[model samples]
Target: MGLFTAIRDVLSGFKSLLIGMRITGREAAKPILTVQYPRETLKMPARFRGHIQLILDPETGKPRCTACTLCEKACPSECIDLDGLRREGDKKKSVSKYMLDFTKCSLCGSCVEVCPSDAIEFSKQYNVVSLGREQFAQMDLYAKVEAEAQAWAAAHPTPPAPPTPATPQPAVTPAASIAPKAS
Candidate 1:
């Protein structure tokens, strides 16, 4: 009885090994699906959420953010902080300092959605690497894009100035004109 049992166990183990090898052989015959990461990069999907950045106005070549604080208020993680100053002739307050604490940010898109001017959008920068935590702690969004904005502004023509009102002509009275005719 013991000899029969040992033979049965050996046969079962052999069968399992053969099954595993068969599966491995079949898989090995298929084409390789591994990506050579360094040589070949995969395109990120359109909906991939990355860090948020301020959108520059094409016409003005300036950040669209009005420094309204709506985005700051809307941020759930409290990662956004910014201020603005109303220039002497400007109607809306321009962004003076826009800071983003990326460490605290959850990339929730609240800031982008609450912005009234469509000022902010998700950046396509997927590969974010830093040596220290402080490196990503306080990212100045305004300063980062300042040079690009300046270059854009320099390249583009300024908007046409508003048409000035013409000088008013002297009012002519009907009686004064008739007297002048001297019939």
Candidate 2:
């Protein structure tokens, strides 16, 4: 009876090992999903989130941020540091400096949602790599937005209006002066 029990245990172990080997064999026969990295890049979907950037106004060709501080307040990690300058005789504050600390940022997208002017959006920079800690500290998001606006303006320039032809006009004769009657 003891010899028969030992034989059954050995057979069960062999069966489990065979099942594992079978799974490994099946997986090895399939195509590899690993990317070659530098040579081959993966296409990210539209909903993929990366870094944060400022949204620019199409008409003005500038950032739509009014420096309302709504986004700064909404950031849970306190990674957003925003600054604004109120020019002389200006009613509203204009964003002068906008910094984003990616080190502490959790990519929560909270800042983008609370923006009233719709000034914040995610950038499609998926390959951001930093070797040093200081490199990931803060990024000048405002400058990047400004550069984008300038580039867009350069690419799509408004055509100048055609000059109108100058035409000679006849002058109207003055009416004869009449004496005013006493009421």
Candidate 3:
């Protein structure tokens, strides 16, 4: 309320803080409960979910994404953005713009959970640093995959088979046509 009261409040706050410090100091002197970080990686619990990643199919050189956005909707932070592309023949559904902004991502793992095609996942890569915003925003999750597919297609183009000769068939005519019209 007054200048004296304000000074008294500040002193009380300092006393409370010192009391907390004393309690922590006592705990520190006792057997350490905190695990050593980095050198000794803490065991993450099964419930401790992590970030989302896209895995490519080795044989097909394509992601398992079937254009299903279950993960996108499932994410509370709305970090996963999937751009669905058309299949070569079908021209209906596939993923064109597969993007996951880990910056905005809260590492909730909702994307991994809801992925039906098993394309999106939690990668083992724990620490990835980026300088520019563009570098961090890695949209081309399947760049390596696309390149592989291109190489395969080029290597194994369909061979053109030689044309086969058709068998000759005898032409047939009616008896009346053979006798000619009786005009």
5-97 in candidate 3: lDDT tens per residue? 999999999999999999999988998677676677666565555556566665555666777778879989876777687777854477777
**Per-residue lDDT tens digits of candidate 1, residues 40-106?**
8778889988899888898788888899999999999999999999988889998989999999999
Can you tell me which runs of candidate 3 are displaced by over 4 Å? 1-51, 90-92, 137-139, 144-183
Which residue pairs overlap in candidate 3's backbone?
85-94, 85-96
The segments of candidate 2 whose C-alpha lies over 4 angstroms from its true place after superposition are: 1-17, 86-92, 161-183
- What are the per-model numbers of colliding residue pairs? 0, 0, 2
Which should have the higher lDDT, number 1 or number 2?
1
Q: CA shift at 137, candidate 1, in angstroms?
A: 1.2
Model 2 lDDT on a 0 to 1 scale: 0.89
Candidate 2 residues 86-177, lDDT tens each?
87876778799999999999999999888989999888889998788786787899988889989989988989999897896887655554
lDDT of 3: 0.71
For model 2, state the Cα shift of residue 154 in Å. 1.1
Question: In model 1, what lDDT does residue 6 have?
Answer: 100
Candidate number with the higher TM-score (1 or 2): 1
Better of 2 and 3 by lDDT: 2
